[model samples]
Target: MQPTPLATSPMPDSEMLRLRQEFVDASWWLTLVYALISSALLPARAWLLGSWRLSDSIIFLFIAGYLLAFGQRRRLGGWWRDSPPVLVMMLGGSTGLLGNGLLGSGLMTLIFANTLVAVLFGRRVVWIAFLYTMGVVLLAAWLYASGRLPPRVSSDYSSSPLAWLMAISSGTLMSFLVLHFVSLYRQRVEALHERLRVQSEEIARLAHHDELTGLPSLRLARDRLRMACHQAERQRSKAALLFIDLDGFKRINDSAGHEAGDEVLRVVAARMVEAVRSVDTVARLGGDEFIVILSGVPDARTATEVAQKIVAAAAAPIPWQGCTLQIGASIGIALYPEHSDTPEDLLRRADSAMYSVKRGGKNGYALHEEPRTPGHTCQPC
Candidate 1:
């Protein structure tokens, strides 16, 4: 049998939300990383090619200001939702222009840009980014070929040491992003599986246990009763089934309202559980009706003593709304192999005995006995 679970807190809509948020925060650091490396390489590229512009310093300031303002923001919504894609595009476009177009080491930056965009946005936006980047590279190539743009001091910049450095740095950034995202994705999947497992167990618990008092429902009680009878038959020991009906419960509901009645039932259920032995089973069959199964009882006398305890426990006044609410228990007992060996027959006999107690008087226990006449009838409670 599965153990009872404590109350569970509400689950988030999707476990992936946490991973996405982490990805957002990480994207900022990634952009800052690219900014630092690319900014450091700017002076080397200018000295190697002997072409530097005022726009280079302006772009560096823009990258720094952008990172300082929004790099640490963890939220994924509002104005900054599209910031990652824009940042990647800026880095990719500028690198491709400064390096000798896509024919040189700038190709790696374009690839890294598309990769980041794909992860942050979806496939469709990545396509748009790719086209936009290709357009920028093509326009720069056309201007340089048409003699509109000035030629660099060194035409062999692609064969220089600076190209190798840029390639290694960009490759490192891409590898780190892929590995980190994969690790985070695995954690999100594990968390989702754990939530599903807990939900399945809670669903099974609700099926077999009463929601109100957290006691075993009729289904679980019946299964336990069958097990008890089978064990008693094998060992030649005895087991008792006590059918309990709460008396004066209707009067309490009628007078104090259902909330008070519910409180009273909770208190009574707790008391009955305390009154029984640890090996015994207490179940709530339905509204105001309960059952107790006792295994390894010596005889009817011992079963009667347990039933007496249940009666006294149920009879205790439950305080509700600054007033005492009185209720009582009417229990009927049927022993295994004495009344009947089968669980169904034992329960029927016990229920019959309980109705008999209701007919005679309320708030008492009775044992199953042979009816004196065939015309006996019971009224609806």
Candidate 2:
């Protein structure tokens, strides 16, 4: 049977929650924006064009301070908490520089560099920084062409159009390069994860299956018996358990080490598999012991035919230990309800019948269809 379904991934990982992390990482910047906005409008500075203003810078700083504090205290400590605040903080600050000030474009460039180094190139921050850089250039162009923004010295800056163009071209190129490498890294990581998942599933399957016989091992056979019994009870149908012991197997094992014995078992198992219907189960209980579970069997006839086929298959030459040694199986059949209802009970009854055959005579099968009553000679019904 195939394996059970895998559990879904818990919370699709840190990379999936893209926007959330950005905001948390940049929490400090909101306060700074407010300060800058407030101070820009304030009529306090008396330098350059007019009075220098401190209101916009102060307001931006205070708001940034509040956001940073909230993120660090309430969100940063927990593993599943929201982002670090700085990533988003820097993102927004860069967007503002797109149109904030013609002279501040260089400042935004420096911020982009810092964000790239902090979040690492393979993360979502790479794209965010690139777009912000493009915005900064776009805003600078608009302001420069519209004549709304003046340079450090208005009269002197107006003549340097070539310098401005060069800056825009170089910065846009740098941002594109960062985006290219980040995309490549993301693909590589995803491929590695998929490979690991497949290998894990393969290892788990190998652990439960017998390689040579293509049957369940001791651990898996026990589990399957329990599951089958539960299904039989639900359907109101009977289940039959058969324990098969190959006579003269020790002679084969001794003559041919384990490799030849294994080959004999594999060949025998293949024939037994064909003898039973696909709906039934054949499992390697261990060494020379095997189990066959017949589900929804209506009566003894169904069990008898399957046991007879197994007898014939074992009687055929199976190349035992490579010398073509003949092998025979002594089968013990025990029915559900007729013998025992539980998986353990059925196994015990089948095992007893098999031993009875081994001691009575080899190359034959037996079944315990009726319970022992008061006192009388019991015969096959």
Candidate 3:
């Protein structure tokens, strides 16, 4: 089987929309976690330091600001949703300035910020965020080296070393947990997209093909017929429509089971395919009725030869169930611009000619001749 276009193309619109919603929901939940963690760490920082430090104050304000921004996200649009990376970067800088320099809380914050950026905006944005974070770390190192930034603790008050360790460790653990789950969600989304792509291809195949004989269905045949007519009109050539009906299909179907009937039909379908060229179209139009589109037919003789080949192929015996089954086909030929210009009219004329052959005798083919009057019947040759 050929590879479907859906299999090769990019992710469809529905999948993109679903992924966007998933990212938005993940960001919201992550922000909520950030708010809760900050709330828990606020009192601990004040207790350990014996007073509220600039970093502690910033964390408190961030908790409130993040909540407010999330609440107004719909009004603020994408900017509100994208503000977390910048907010976290600010928090990291403040903590680094208040705590140790680049080695302590600052380094941990940068790592967590990079993870958040990856989860929120994917790989392309993470690199930009990473460079910005490195710049901040270098700036912090220079300030500390120049003696402009204060030491880890103020000279007047001493803080517990364990407090700094607990803050950094807890934040790192939370960020890691969020990153792990985000990765899992992305994998799940990819799997779902693959399943949807397979289903879409199957649906497209079924819509254009017949289930029994593996031939083009009636709908696809009509489309091809219309396209062939347009091409013939452009090239100033003639196209022929051949309508075929099995002579004793109903009798075989009624005598034997549907399984046998299906086998016979498949055999007939195969024969019809062998009779046509690569560019010609052969389609099953339900039951025992089939249509063949012969493009660039120079004259009626070429069309008759193709119809005769189909008739002869159908007359061949098919071996089945320790017995030989026999059948015949009656075909009607209609030429474009001679019999009818439109696909519908051509089909009707061909069908009428096939009935004319059936009225004369089975196992024969006929060409549609123009009617003399509006009420006059079609004559077949």
Candidate with the greatest lDDT versus the true structure = 1
Error of 2 at 5 (Å): 24
**lDDT over C-alpha atoms for residue 185 of model 3:** 68
> Mind giving the per-residue lDDT tens digits that candidate 1 earns over 94-199?
5457545554545566666766676667778778878977886787788777878744436665576787677677678767876898899887777777887898
Model 3 RMSD in Å is: 10.6
Q: Per-candidate TM vs. native?
A: 0.71, 0.57, 0.57
Clashing pairs in 3: none
Could you give the C-alpha RMSD of every candidate to the true structure, in order shown?
6.7, 12.8, 10.6
lDDT of 2 at 110: 42
Candidate 1 total steric clashes: 0
lDDT values for all models: 0.76, 0.63, 0.75
Against the true structure, candidate 2 reaches a TM-score of 0.57
lDDT of 2 by residue, 113-224 (tens): 5554445444465666566566766776787678886443344433445335434543554355446445655764575577668767766766787766768776787787
Name the regions of candidate 3 deviating beyond 4 angstroms.
1-173, 370-381
Query: Candidate 2 overall Cα lDDT vs. reference?
Result: 0.63
